[model samples]
Target chain A: MDLGSINPILLVASIMVSATPILLAAIGEMVVEKSGVLNLGVEGMMITGAVVGFAVAVNTGSPVLGFAAAALASAVLSLSFGVLTQVFLSNQVATGLGLTLVGLGLSALIGKPYEGMKSPTLPKLDIPLLGDLPVLGRMLFSHDIMVYLSLALVAAVWAFLKFTRAGLILRAVGESHDAAHALGYKVVRIRLMAIFFGGACAGLGGAYLSLVRVPQWTEGMTAGAGWIALAIVVFASWRAGRVLIGAYLFGGVTVLQLNLQAAGARVPVELLSTSPYLITILVLVLISARGIHGAPACLGRPFHASS
Target chain B: MIRLEKRPQPSQLWTVLTPVLAVLLTMLVGGIMFAFLGTDPLEAIRTIFWDPLFNPQFAGFTRPQLLVKAGPLILIAIGLSIGFRAGIWNIGAEGQYIMGAICGAGAGLAFYPADSVLIFPLMILCGALGGFAWAMIPALLKVRFGTNEILVSLMLVYVAENLLASVASNLLRNPEGMGFPGSRNFKQWPAAHNAELISGTGMHWGVAFAFIAVILAYVLMSRHIQGFNIRLTGEAPRAARFAGVNPARIVILCLGISGALAGMAGLFEVTGPAGQISIDFNSGYGFTAIIVAFLGRLHPVGILLAGLLMALTYIGGELAQLMLGVPGAAIQLFQGMLLFFLLATDVFTNFRLSLGRKEPA
Candidate 1:
């Protein structure tokens, strides 16, 4: 029950690490949704990335190769989803759920040999000047590169959606695929790209779990993180900056819960563990109740050029 | 170049053919996958699709287990089909299932050491109500706040899992069994056990309920006004609204039905085969039922057949794992492939591929 045992600096530092996966996933999904596509296979993609990343890192002894392979594998996996939904015009929700099932099964099959195996983890990058700073350096500058990369990605996504014509076109495609197609834009192709990008980001997030966070391979390791990321997208109202805040807020809750458990708080362990999911649900309710649902108009709609 | 043209109406022929086609496609692709895993492809496929039902050594025991496995799947899928028909996604049936088992089992356990016939019926009622109430959360939110039921329902699964662990370890721990994290075995309590009505046939109360649900669902979908409304809502929401269909009522009704069925399935499992409320009582029946609902074309009869087919995969997958050294996860991958192929082939239902170049507009 002694709350003083919890280190504030370490808590902030760990929040960055904890939030990286969801941040990466949410940002990518944001892009995909912005392009008027909803790919609910984030969990599947992330888990695939986790296993592939772990296997590659273990075999090659290189975390970088592991991350790249994970991104590629998930991107390829997402293409299957893109093809089914975009090219074949399958129902997006069902196809996405199928993708998740496939990912879970495939990852488990591939991860069988790698169970309990440890992989090379990502190295932390300490900013030369900032590393020596008082509390700020310890809180932010000393985290792993993925944490920074995820933050940079949020900023990049914000800029891309805000200042870029291609981003606008992507948004246009998402808002009304028919309009985009009539304007001579390849709606399906753009959606496929966005789906691919989403998969890659989900992969990086999953790889972060196995290679950096957990630092070991376990079956079903991503364990609802992808779903949380999806909830974060809704909580953020599909805005990039709010997505960052949502991820950090979720990360803060997760870290705080774990810290409470470690500090032997009076709350039951199960309640503490369940807090993150409950918090996500609460945030979703609060956000949705505000009626600020900025979901893309064409989200989850199958695109067929022929109408 | 090939071109797809939308059919004036959905093809009934393709509707019946897709599931069969999807199964064959799964066997072919799954065989190749098995081959890569160093198992004999034909042997693995045969073992998965054939051995469980036909192998003389195992068929005697596996035959009845098929009913045991399919019973819950059919029940849950029947519920999900209703919601899916109205374009309402209640993806968190797994959570509802857990809650149902908890409430049903807890109710029965409260009357522990008492010999009363009413206990079992009361448990059933509690189980169904438990699931229905759990489902109402997402339904109410969606109706009131415009919340996405898919995400909310899915999120609740995690919450439910945690709650399950908590109850199993703390609230319902078997006191007489040296502090183990499970309730008293229902098998030992004849009053609460959902035992097989026809011994050795695996026909329990759950299986009976599943059959009843199939006929009921079939009637509801084909012969009822509510069915028409559900279909209309899915196909044309605006038209449905114009026809005086209350969208909120439909959402609530659909979610409630699915949740109750899923919950009943869970209660039946915990009482019958599982024999107790444990942390891992749910075997992903809720999620797998989603695939069942889709594969059956959201039709009750289709779901019944699909449920049995999926049940065969489960039994066969286990047999394959034991006999051919196939990894257990391969079966999950196989099921996933079935859904993927089904969705891919479903394109034929509404569109026909033209082999020639498209006509100029």
Candidate 2:
């Protein structure tokens, strides 16, 4: 039994890549939840984005345009959710679930034609000095633009939540919508914006998968990545930095398991592959020990004017 | 005359009728969807809802499969309904189901070729305990740390899948079989086999247990003090607290029951219909059960019927896949449509759909 079989370098790099989608989606959902709405439709939104992004990229031959189209499509889909839950005051749990179902069906419908069609490859934007650096280059710099974007988005989101007035207001609403409402802030409008932002982010995450990761559209391709993103948000405890940590950790576990399987480890390939999910649950159990940090007070509750 | 009013309180009539109305509305919307997809709407509806049960051409084979399919669904849904009623969402039943099957199968296969009577009962216990233990993680987090059970439990499903895959390939691999990524055949092993009681009927003890679960659940929910406590917590938390109903206790109980039942369903499935453990052993039954629980309005009988109806679509949808050139995804989307449309139209049950005069904007 060669215990030293795990290649730590390539292992970490693959983990980062694997973690990218979950990170992107979790960050997006974090913003959404921070703005005082719980969208369980992340998986739906992500999958919808996955197929649509793949389709648009394949047709237009621009990965950038494909990502944009994906975000716009998902954002549009999420707008319907906003109208139903935010405007109509329906049950958030049920409506969000409904949105997922609808998104899934809609994606399947659209993706039928695009199935098996390879997406235009996203080029790795190598950083000059950084990407050229020996071992770390492959581990960090030599990756597609979406990978960098996910990292930047995390930083940008962190700063926005901490310093910006709009972020403050969003936080206020999440903490207590009634307080935000009394302070002359429009809760519904703020929430709607947040919902769209989250949806777009989730869409981008999905697009990253189809456009970059898997490079093809398949039915149910997101494969619960969206749900994992949702969990990462909770695991992150609603903080941007922690979200990065959680996502990467989950990704590392997933990639390591896959690598181990590829290395021809004596262990069953299935068990090794599933290690990430198990590790995610274990991490969630641990992170949940402290309760989630910065969780919005009014999260998952539909804010009614009369109530 | 006791007239139905939009009561200041929640309407009981609406509670009883919403699931039925949701089904009808789903049919209507699904019919439109079928038409949009270039299939005859009425025929699609018939195939989805009717053919599996009544059509002489298909019912012979399809009828028994309905119970086989519905058994796990009803089991999983019933467990989910309990947590839902308590506002403790366990969306990771799929993970729990996978774990149950893995653990149960693993336990049974541990004694391979040694035909002891203890194998079947031990598997059942392992299956239930496996699910119960898996469910306990989320429940414990929610109770002890104020963690979001929805997220924790859901993420765990993926973890459970990974475990199932690993076990199937490594520890549980059949020695004689040529490099297959699956466990030893439990059906052939009499002590572990969950075979049909009445031949060709497809009815197994699991189906019997599901019925028993419905009765047991109905009694617990309607007759017992704990049931009242669960309803109270779901309906009016403040009132429940005032009534001395322990919130933490209810969470534990609800999650435990749900997890155990989900596990039992998984155990039965692996032992009977599924035949062996593999990477694709779990069929999203836990997630679908969430839809089933809601579709059934969280009532036991409603869940039973809803389970059966959902099963019909599974069989019919498979038929459509074989007969028409319709992709498997289209059928999945068709199933998902039931939940989406049901939820969308459920708005009517709560809020009256009436055209309003324009407000002075």
Candidate 3:
């Protein structure tokens, strides 16, 4: 096989695009989990956002509105999860799975008519001088607005968690919910807000898929992206910057597998298709070696106001 | 001010009543969903919950199928309940099930066209081993590195599906057939087939195994030191450690046993009703077993009954598909409502739900 058959530069560029949704979703989930709540409904919220985003964009011919609608829909769904698990003190695992089922069903119903509809095209933002640079330009500067936004979000989240009062309060709640409750913080309210933000982020990620990547609505289209994002949260040790890195790494693996198949690699198509999942597991196993640093201490624990 | 008052001991009444309460709540919510779907809510509810077991036109077929469907679910759920009791969530039973089917089918096909008695036993062993080995990945990782087993196990499912496809399309493709992506029909293989032990009733070796699992699980949970340790670790980890229960060993053992049982269920299905391994060999039994485990209250007898109830929904869902043209997703939502309500109503287990009086400011 010719070495020239594959362009390394294009490979890197495409991998970044592929990783954008995961990065966005993971970053959002990182913040949510950091705020003393484990919202396992990312998959459900993402899919809902995907179809809602697609339908709105297709109807209004505005990608911005599509993204906004996706975030809003996902945020609303996330709020349901937050209210149930936080206020009613339902088991998070069961509620999360239910959310996924409901999301899949709801998306199918809403997306029924838009089954074959195409999405509005997102405008590409090419850096004037940087995009024209020989090799690095294709590797980094040339991408849709979402790619940059994902990276920017990572930085923003990193700063917020590291420096801000709100971030500190969120972390305090996550670390010791009882202590935070004793200290007079509105633990449930903060968590609900965090869950909403996480849902909105996941929605944006889902919208990116239907509105930009695939640019079409299909039933179950967000296909395990939510789960992958969850894994990324773990892989990143619940750190925002690490989540960005993990998302990109996963994205690279996905792109690499597809590219390998396209380039007629010796591996079977199914093996190539399964590579992304296998890689995610392997990466997670490796990251586990570093220990669960930055993991919120109080995740998944139901907060009862009284002892 | 109102507070969540602690009972001297958790109420046993709430324990038994939770599932019933959950079912009622699901019926109410699910009935509204059916109404939204434009079907007669009452008729839809009856079709889903009542008609499958009693309607003469359907009961004959559905009744026997219940045992067949419940067999794997009960077997898998029994294994998962062990892990759940030890506070380990083995969410990747689906992947383990697939691996077991693949490994078991692979073993049976390795001795293809042979009419020997050892083939079925060998298949069962390989299936369990395959599932166990696949499960060990997360268990070992969790023990060694303290990784989150939930994500690791669940993610492996996609990997296992790809492996199934690879094997079916290539290595396991029947030579006699013209390039079909599946193994030689297990039913046609006299020794490998898990044929019905009771004729026309659909009762097979798997159902027998499920019953045996329930008895063994009941004994283990009630009369064994390991069972006590598991319960202690789940309910009070610090106390369990102080009492000399090794947490690491428990995690590995719990995950290992669950994975093996899940794998066996997969193996049995592939050889018996499913007939062979195909790309779509899995029917999401692994995922559904979680619901069964919880619905059964993580008790062996409870799981047996819960498995049957869940199996009823599968049969009824199929009937709904045929009779009402309702999409399969609606059925998924219907089943999902059970768990949603189950978790929601579990609140009453620890807290009373009486309305609190508002004091004037």
- Using DockQ, give the best candidate's number: 1
Interface RMSD of each: 0.7, 3.0, 1.7
What's the CA error at residue A269 for candidate 1, in Å? 1.4
Give lDDT tens digits, candidate 3, residues B254-320.
Answer: 9999999999999999999899889897898998898899999899999999999999889888887
DockQ of each: 0.90, 0.46, 0.64
lDDT of 3 by residue, A256-284 (tens): 88888888888789888987788777887
Q: Can you tell me which runs of candidate 2 are displaced by over 4 Å? A: A1-16, A101-116, A126-142, A256-272, B1-7, B111-119, B352-361
Please tell me what DockQ candidate 1 reaches. 0.90
Q: Which stretches of model 1 miss by more than 4 angstroms? A: none
Worst ten in a row by lDDT for model 2 chain A: A1-10
| CAPRI docking class of candidate 3 | medium
Which digits, one per residue and each the tens of the lDDT, describe model 1 over residues A1-307?
Answer: 9999999999998888888888998999999899988888999999999999999999999999999999999999999999999888999999989999999999999999998877888778868999889999999899888888899999999999999999999999988988989999999899999999999999999999999988898988888999999899988889999999999999899999999999999999988998998888888888888985788999888877777
Q: Please give me the DockQ of candidate 2 compared with the native complex.
A: 0.46
User: Each candidate's TM vs. the true structure?
Assistant: 0.99, 0.90, 0.95
List lDDT for all candidates, in order: 0.93, 0.84, 0.87
Alpha-carbon error at B99 in model 1, in Å? 0.7
DockQ pick, better of 1 and 3:
1
In order of DockQ, best first, we have 1, 3, 2
Whole-model lDDT for model 1 versus the true structure? 0.93
